[model samples]
Structures are given as structure tokens and as C-alpha cells.
Target chain A: MNQQNILFTNNTAQAIDTAINNIRPNGIFVLTDKNTAVDVWPQVKAESTMMSEATLITINPGDTNKDLKSATLIWENLINGGATRHSAMICLGGGMITDIGGFTASTFKRGIKFINMPTTLLSAVDAAVGGKTGINFNGLKNEIGVFSPASHVIISTRFFNTLQKRELLSGYAEMLKHGLIDSAATFHKLIDSDPLEIDAGHMLELLKASVEIKRRIVNDDPYEQGIRRALNLGHTAGHALESLAMKKGKPVPHGYAVAWGCIIELILSHTHCGFPTNTLRNAAQYIFSHYGTPDINCSDYQDLLEFMHHDKKNISSECINFTMLSNVGRINIDRTATESEIKTALDIFRDLAGA
Target chain B: MNQQNILFTNNTAQAIDTAINNIRPNGIFVLTDKNTAVDVWPQVKAESTMMSEATLITINPGDTNKDLKSATLIWENLINGGATRHSAMICLGGGMITDIGGFTASTFKRGIKFINMPTTLLSAVDAAVGGKTGINFNGLKNEIGVFSPASHVIISTRFFNTLQKRELLSGYAEMLKHGLIDSAATFHKLIDSDPLEIDAGHMLELLKASVEIKRRIVNDDPYEQGIRRALNLGHTAGHALESLAMKKGKPVPHGYAVAWGCIIELILSHTHCGFPTNTLRNAAQYIFSHYGTPDINCSDYQDLLEFMHHDKKNISSECINFTMLSNVGRINIDRTATESEIKTALDIFRDLAGA
Candidate 1:
């Protein structure tokens, strides 16, 4: 949403150079995960001259490590490294890294400036656009965080090559959701593209489109008060399914879970918000055909409901609140659906997926 | 220095009622310490009708508990209490409660609105006015925090009735610092007033003036970029001494430490910034006569220096940065002092204390 804070550049090195030159920080703290440190840091270091003097703070890669324990570790590292209020942190990696790193920078000395260089498709389009920074606690997603945006967000599609097929697909899922929420034409374009086969240039265009969709929504409502709820259209169901999958020990990638969630929620939209049934059917067919259905059944319905109850969007103790679409680009927030209606929607998804 | 967010009121209950009416929160969570839960909550509850349904969260009283552990416990309480983005937190105690509670409220669900009801003189003039929220980590004072202001801050002199003499004096130290920084007339007025003998009405007038002084500085520079550094005149050496005393098993009251820090820093002001020697001697005589010197001697100098090294204001690794006074009312910030000059300041403090 902070248009001036984000830079879309083909050459990340040049972007980093410009940001560092402008900030003129007293010191630099670079945060990365083991995965990024090995796969991505060399390229980043080679490009930015400042990397030689920066303190490298690495954490183990994965969502499981994105917790308070990791945050405490990062805080201690920043303190021991003598990071001052004038110091700037460079977060280079996926969502987990940026979330934790941004949180660390925001809380350290009552907040220092942070520059985000998102290395994954999910982070580039989603996390980097929003000033949301946090870590999970007590098995809840983003349970603890602050709404502090990075001073600069540098997005480069070259990091896409480092992503596995599943990782790439995970980010593509959000792109689909953005399209579905933004316009019918965008939705069709996303459905028609083979995510795994997209070239760097084309994928960069898609990433920019996805980021722009989020940027507009966030700019209109940075605090998620009203219009920004549209951004959570798939997240209501998607997050529940993701939490359920994680609980079941077969954690699905966020994008895949979101892909599955979109299919189920689209059916809910048709029933609750009078969305066109044809559009719902078309959406389900395309998403399921590409990502396939998550291995969830009627048995997982209660767990999914339980997870949904804890969703930050739901302010009430009863009845799940959802962002339902009357049609593509049309959203109705704070819509409550009954348990049976939700069950029926899952059943529709099961039938569509042939599971 | 969020002028719109703060309310100075004689009727605490009416202010709270108005704040609750305006915010229309989903729920209310009240944070207090064991001391306040017994001594202060009753008065607040009787005044504010909203206290009836609010969830009560309590922690032990003291600076020792103002750490990440306390923050974690408070977060758990908020999460378990079903606090949503719409929920409002009422921080009802001194600095420790507000610091931990404000940090908890600011971070929970990426921030919920928090109201501060400062119950101690120290908090009334200092913590309640500033948007500083934090918890100590790894033996560092306020090492982790955020610059997030409360939705409303309610200050009542009636709460001062519960403070012990030491607590009252602890706050008076800061009030003196405010006077010293604001004007020569204000400084003389503060030194002349007997903190212990002053009536509640007179004390309340002084409190308002102190708060106003801080409000002006913070308003001009909320993030402490320039002029706000003047407010840190005594804090540089005060925080270092406070931390040393805390580490030494005999934690001196904050105001007492600040009073001590003022005397030492005034000497530094004279040496480095050419502050009037006669004014420094008079100020030291008044402060030491009233609050007797702390037992720290030459042996504790190294620990004090070490603690100052970790002070958040320090932008570099070398010289200690201080806010020195050009005169009683004039201040020069970001001045570096050598170890010998610092030792000389301490020696002056000791000799004046008859050590």
C-alpha cells in the first residue's frame, strides 16, 4: 500500500545499492533462513557492496521455526551485535523470514528501519506489499505481530528459479485469488496459464499484477478496516484448511491450501451471496484441475471449523465470518455462514474434486 | 505526544466512559499488577462502569517482572480471552504495567486499541505521555518495545494517594528533570518545593505542568529524531546507574537513580558544554540534600559505562553519547564524553555526597 516504499526492479543489486545509499544506515543487519543463505545470499551479497560489512543473521528455514523462540533469538542477536536505532535490517527470503525479520526490526529499540527483499513468489506479492509483520504463537497463524511496513521493499523475479515446483505453485495460488477478486479477465488469464511452465519475463509480469492488486486494496485500507477485507476472500477458508493440514502432519503449501480453499469458498459465495453458480463451477474446475483437491474429507470438517473460529477476522465467538463474493470483483465482508451451509460447501468441493 | 489521544481529567470515570463509548470495543481487558489489583483497581472500577465485564489480567509488581516473560504471559491471557482487533485494553498501573500491557496490546492480533490509566506519579508524567511501549530483555531496561501510543491516556492525581514515599520521590526526580530542561524559573520552582510536604492539589498542578512539558517535546519529535533528545538529558546516566543498581541486587528506585544521574550529568554539562558551575553546585546541593546519594562508588563506574554502551540512543561503538546542558534551561544533545571526564563527574557526585 505504501507505493513509495516498494520498488519493482529487474536488477535487485542496483535497487539495494540505491536504498542503502539513501538510508545511509549506521549499520546493516541481514536476516535470512538457511535456505536463502545458501541459495540466495551469494547473489545478493555480490550485487550490494554493503553486504560485506553487514552482520549475517541466519535462522533455520520453515514455518515451524517462525515462532516466539525464533523472534527472541533474533532480538538477542541484534542486541549482541550492537544494533543501534540507526541500524537497518535487510530481510531476504520468503514470508517467514520477512515476517520474523520485520517484527524484529520493528520492535528493536522501538523500531528501526527495515528493507525487505522478498525471495519467494508468495512474499513478493503478499507479504512485501502489506506492512503486516508477526510470528505464530500457540499454533495460531500470525497470532502476534505489529502493522509496521518496511522502509523499502525490493522485488526481483530472478529468485523464482530458486523455488521448487511446489513453492512456485504455492505463490501462484495467491495470484489466482487476486485475479478472482480483482477482475474476471485477470481470473481467466491466471486459470489459462501453466504456472510451472511460465518463463521469467512472463512470471515477472504476473507477479507485478498480483502485487498491484494487493497494493490497491491495502492503500485504500491499510489497517484492514473495510475495503481490505476483500484481500482475505480466500484466506477465511484457506487459513483454516492450512491449519488443519498442518495439524494432520501433512502440511500443504500455503498456495495449494488456498487453491483448495478458493474452490470451497466459491461454493459458499454462490449459496450465501448469490454469486453466479456458473462462475463458481468454472472456478472450481480450473483450480482443482491445476492444484488438485487437498486430501480432506467430512472427518476434517469440525477441525476446519475450529481453526476458522480462531481466525483474526472473526470478532464473534460464534458463526464463522467470511468475505463472500457476489461476483468477481464484488466482495461482501463480515458475512456469517451457518455450520450446515459450510458443510454443504465442503461437500460440493469434494464432489467437484472427485474425492 | 499524541495530543488528541491524551486526556488530563479530574474525573477518571467520566473520561473512561467517554473513551469506551467512542471506541465501542468488542470487549475490554484490564491489565494490572498485584499491587494495583488490590490498591487501585477498586477506585478505577467504582469510577468506570465498564470494568464489570472486563477480563482481569494481573502480574507481580516490580521492574524485575517487566520482561519478555511477562509480555508472553499477558499475550497468552489476551489470546485466551478472545481479544480481537476491536477489543480494547485498559492498562491500569504504573510504568511496568503500562509498558508490558501496552506492548501486549500493540502486538496482539497486530495491535488492538489500549487505554492507559497511569496509577503512579512516575507513569503519570512520563510513561503515560509517551507512546513508548516495551519490556526488558536479557537484563536490559526497555530493550524490546514499540513506539505505539494508547488510544487514550487518563491521568488522575487520586491514584497518587496509594504511592509510597519512595515511589513519590522516584517520580519527583523526573519532574525535576522536566523543570531543569524547560526553564530556569521551572527548575527553581521544583528545587524549592518539598516533594514530601506538598498537598495533593499542589502536586496535581505540578504533575500537569510536568506532563505538559513532556507533551511539548514529544509532540515536536514523536520519534526522538532531534529536539526530543533534550528529554533524555538525565536518562543517559540515569538509566546506566539504574541498570547497575538493579544488577547489583539492590535496585534503587528509578527516581532516586535519576536524581543521582542528574547531579552527575550536570557536572558533565559543566565540563563539556560550559554550563555555569555555580548553577551546577546549587542544583547538586538541592538534589542531594533532599534525596541523599545512592551508595554507588568508584568501583561501580565500569558497570555503569557498560550499561550506557547498550543505551538505545548510542549510534556508534566508541564514545558515550549524552544530552548535556548548556545552562539550566538550554540543552545540547549527542555530546560525547570521555571515560576520565565521566569518572571526574562521578567523583564530584561522591564528594558532594560526603562519601
Candidate 2:
């Protein structure tokens, strides 16, 4: 917890100003992907002074590059830029950038400090709040990492204006999860919003609500020992789908994959956790109608199942999941759904989404 | 803390049997150096059931070889061998193997369990016991690492029977440090032992004492918050000298560099901490008479000092060191020694050691 203030602002310029004035890091190493450097750095540079102490380093964008090679390149950039143990790194892109940059800062000389200025809607709400940083190794996602918090996380809403509609739709899925896990009020707010019409202020508020829900859960169980597992309500299937997408090079945006997985997990919850059948079906239909559906093929079912078994969340060779109950704002982390039930749920989602 | 029933046995065959029956790791990965694999693997193969596990991965040894490349190779081995998250690795060579192997284990899939069965005397006493594991990157020693305890640590003395005399002497320097810090009995034992006549039993006892001393210090401050800086006693100059040696491709064994650094630090302590002049002079003379003198050129002094200034240990730009007084069992950490006094102490050691 070396970070002083975890601040959120709608203006990127103000966020940068607060970071420079409040943190006054020994030096600033702004980390971004090539796409982000192209799309975001102009806004970042326009807001901040070119101090003698700061240097900028850019990584390539996208999940394919979010592996050990990228982390190594980032480390090299830091060293070549004369970054020391006291230097602070600013991760300024999507989840992939944050994951790689945060881990580089955490491991450089045992550790340094870092800040997250997540641009993607998914990352703004999830990756920025959690201290989880990592790089994939050998086909396994997040196989190498440490759970070290950044000094501060600055969430700015300016980037939302530039986000693709599809990405925003994908990100809203997690907002729904926050409601299903602990807050009916937040859920209703999300349901009431015109996803297409939402402005930066509304987006920031949703981000805050979503982050607050996560922070409370993590505060009680930072290391995922028990209660924090509740946060993974849809992630058991979500990660498997993401892994399959990644391996095939189809590469679904992480949030979209999670949204698809949530539909399946909800159906399974109805069977195993005694969730109301209509409530689960309605939620599944809502998500599928909004985010479209994952292109899961019958031919790839076994491969998906294999990926599920290999999910880091699984224990004792079982495709264990943190399924939910019927009530909105309540979930069960300890529930396990059978393989056949999981297949049935996925099949139902495919039929419901007509995919 | 995860590790239990750690053993430092005297027989290699017995150590393997002990690991098999006692620890019962899910899978076995025997880490060996090129030297050990060529000379000792034949005997090791005849003695242990390494192939009983899913696979065996052979890696070249040495500090240069301990890098991201080797980590990748090990990862490939694990994947090919079907090593699950439960799999554990057993490092069976010197300090370099343990550092790299432990780092690989600690980082793969966030982490897996591993054991240290240090073969070299230098590793048996120092590297094996500490939870610190890392690999050098971009010419920086231990540039990337994590502080996670091994599943178990086994420091069998049987390996030391074949250890080169130089390596044994290097490890003995640490034994002397233990004596100087808190153990009069250990100091007496080290002083009395004839280098040629030393046996495995005596080495095991010394290793045990050193481990206990390190363990206590770590328990008080697991994450190196405060009191743990005392461990940096000889590391300031030692690290610089070692780094210089590594860059030169004629790396000095870690203990050799540290031993020389200790003599310099002791002299500086007298000038800065009101240390008795007679005690400082006598200690330098004793080491010079026993271990001969270290050879360092005047041109390298500035380079060494520059390196020390960048050491991860320094809190600020100012260099801090742990220095000792004539009272053999007492040392003061968090002491600041003047540059002139440090130069004078180095000059004195240079003259005494006939550098």
C-alpha cells in the first residue's frame, strides 16, 4: 500500500495533474501499448509537464503480447531509461497493459511503485482496483505474477468517449455482476441506463460502485482464501472461454468472454444452487441480447471442457464454479455444478442467443 | 512457512530417500549444473529414482545460464512432463541452480512448491535457507525475484564431501559472520578447524547454526522492513565486487567477495562507530593471515563505489552499511561511514592483504 491516494476523475488532464502534484514520484515511467501510445499518449502528454525526471515506455497492444516477452521488454526499457528502485511506473492502457506493466514494477529490483490509469472500460472498473498483476507463460494466462498493490490507481472517464460500443457493452457485464453479488441498487441503475447513451459521469459512478463492491470483498479476503472467491462468480467459465479464444487466436475481449460465461454460470446456479429458473433465464437472455453470443462450436466442446478443467480455479480435477442463487445481490462461492449441467447450460445459452 | 520437515542429511542416497518418503512431492524435477550432471549425474542416476516421476529436465549451470531462457526451458519441461500446480522441484546443484530453480518454481503459474538440496557448501549455508530467490537480468544480480519460502530446505553435507576447497572456504566465511554476530561457540569452532580436516558433521552443524540465525532475523521482519538490514553487513562492497566480477566473466564466488568486504567494513566501523582501533587492525590481520589477501585495483575502487550507491539496500542516495566493533559478537547496522574513512579502510586492507 505504498500509494497515497486512489483517485478517480472524469478529466484525464486533472487525473494526471493530481498524480504529478500528489505523488511526486522520483521519476515517472509511463507504460502503454503501441496502440495506446498512439491513441492515449497525446492526451496524456498534453495534460502533463515534460519533467526532467520522467521517461516514457510503450509496449505493444492486445492480449497476444501480454506474455513474458513483453514484460522483459518493459523491464529492459526501465533499465535503459535509468529507472531505479524508487521510480514509479504508470500503466496507461487496457487490462493487458496494466497486467504487464504492474508486474514489471512489482518485480524490478524485487519491487518499485506503480499507478494504474486504465483506459478500457473493463480495466477501469476491475484491473485498476485489484493489485493483481501478471504475465502469461507457456499458454497459461497469468501463470507468472505477484499480488502487489500499485501505489495509486487513477481512473479517468475521458477514455470512455473513445471506447467502441461493443467494448462498453462487454464491460457492462461486470457491472451486472456487482449487482448480482451484493447491491440491488447498483443493478437497477445499470438496468435503467441506456448503455449507448451513458455519459462519462454516469460511467464513472458505475465504475465507483463496481470498484467499491470489489474493494469490500477483497478487503475481507485479499488473498482469495474464501470470501473473495465470490468475485469469481462467472470467471470459472469466463477464464476457460478466454483461454480457448486466446489459444485459437480469435481473442474475444475479456469482458465479452466473461459476459458469455455469466449466462452459462447463471443457468448452472439454477440447477445446483436452487436459483429461480425464470430469474436465471431472464438474466441469461438479457446478457446475450446485449453482448451477442460466444461462438462456441459443438466440435470444440471437449476442448472447452479441457480448458475448463485446466482453469487455475479448479481443484481436484473438478470444474468447480462459484455459482449464484436466485436473489439479485446474493451469490454462493462454494457451489459446484456438474459437467453435464454445465454442458446443458451452455447449450441453452446458444439456443437463447440463436448462435 | 509452507515447508515442513526440512532435512540436511550427510548422504546423497539417504537425502533422496528422505525426500521420497518424507516430503513426497507430487512430481520430481532434479536441477543440476553442467558440471554436476556430467560428473555426478551418473552416480545420481544410479542412486535415485528421478525418472519415477513424469520427466527429467537437464539444464546447464552457472550464473550466466540462470536467466529467463532457462526459466522458459524449465516451463517447457514442466508442461511436457505433465507437472501440475502441485508439482515441486528439487534443486540439486550449487547456489546458481538453487537461485534459478527456486525462481522458476516461485513464478510458474504464480508459484509452485520447491525444495533446496544445496550441493555446494556456499549454497548450503547461505542461499538454501533464505526465502529470497531470483535471477540476474541485464547484468544486475538478482534483478528479478520474490521473497517466498521453499516448501522445504534440505542441506545435506554429503555433497560438501566433494566440494572444492575454495567453495568450502567461501562458505566458512559466513560461518565466521554468524560467530561475529551472535555465536561465540561457532567462532571458536571455525577458528579451531583445519580446513583440510573439516568433515561433513561439522559443516552440517555450522549450516544449522547459520540457518537458525537467518531464520530468527527473518521471523522478526519477514518482508525486510527494519532490522533485516543487518543482513546487509558485508553486502555493500560485496555486491559491487561481485557485480564487477560477473561483468568481467570471472565471477568471484559470493562468499569470497563478502569475506573481503567484511574486513573493509570492520575497519570503517572503527572510524565511524567508535570501534577500538586495535580490534579492527587485529581482525584484518587475522583474515589476511588465514585467507591471504584480495586483489582489487585502484581504478576499480570508484567503479565499486558507484555500484554500491545504486544497491537496492540504500534508502536514499546516501549509502548505509552494517559495520562491526572489536567486540566480536556485536555489530551495528544503520550506520553511516564517511567516504574518506571508507577509502582509508580499503587502503589499509589493500596493504595488509598485499593487493
> Model 2 over residues A167-280: C-alpha lDDT tens digits?
787677787777778766777787777677887787788788888888888777766657877777778788888888877878888888887777777777777767777667
Q: Please report how far candidate 1 places residue A148 from its true position, in Å.
A: 0.8
DockQ list for all candidates:
0.87, 0.44
For candidate 1 chain A, the 10 contiguous residues with the lowest summed lDDT are A1-10
Compute the lDDT of residue B215 as modeled in candidate 2: 72
lDDT of 2 by residue, B43-143 (tens): 76777665344255678777788888887888778766656566778777888888888888877656677777787777777777667788888777788
True contacts kept of 1: 0.88
Colliding pairs, model 1:
none
Residue A332 C-alpha lDDT in model 2: 74
Q: Least accurate stretch of 10 residues (summed lDDT) in model 2 chain B? A: B317-326
Q: In TM-score terms, which candidate is top?
A: 1
Q: Candidates' lDDT values, in order? A: 0.87, 0.73
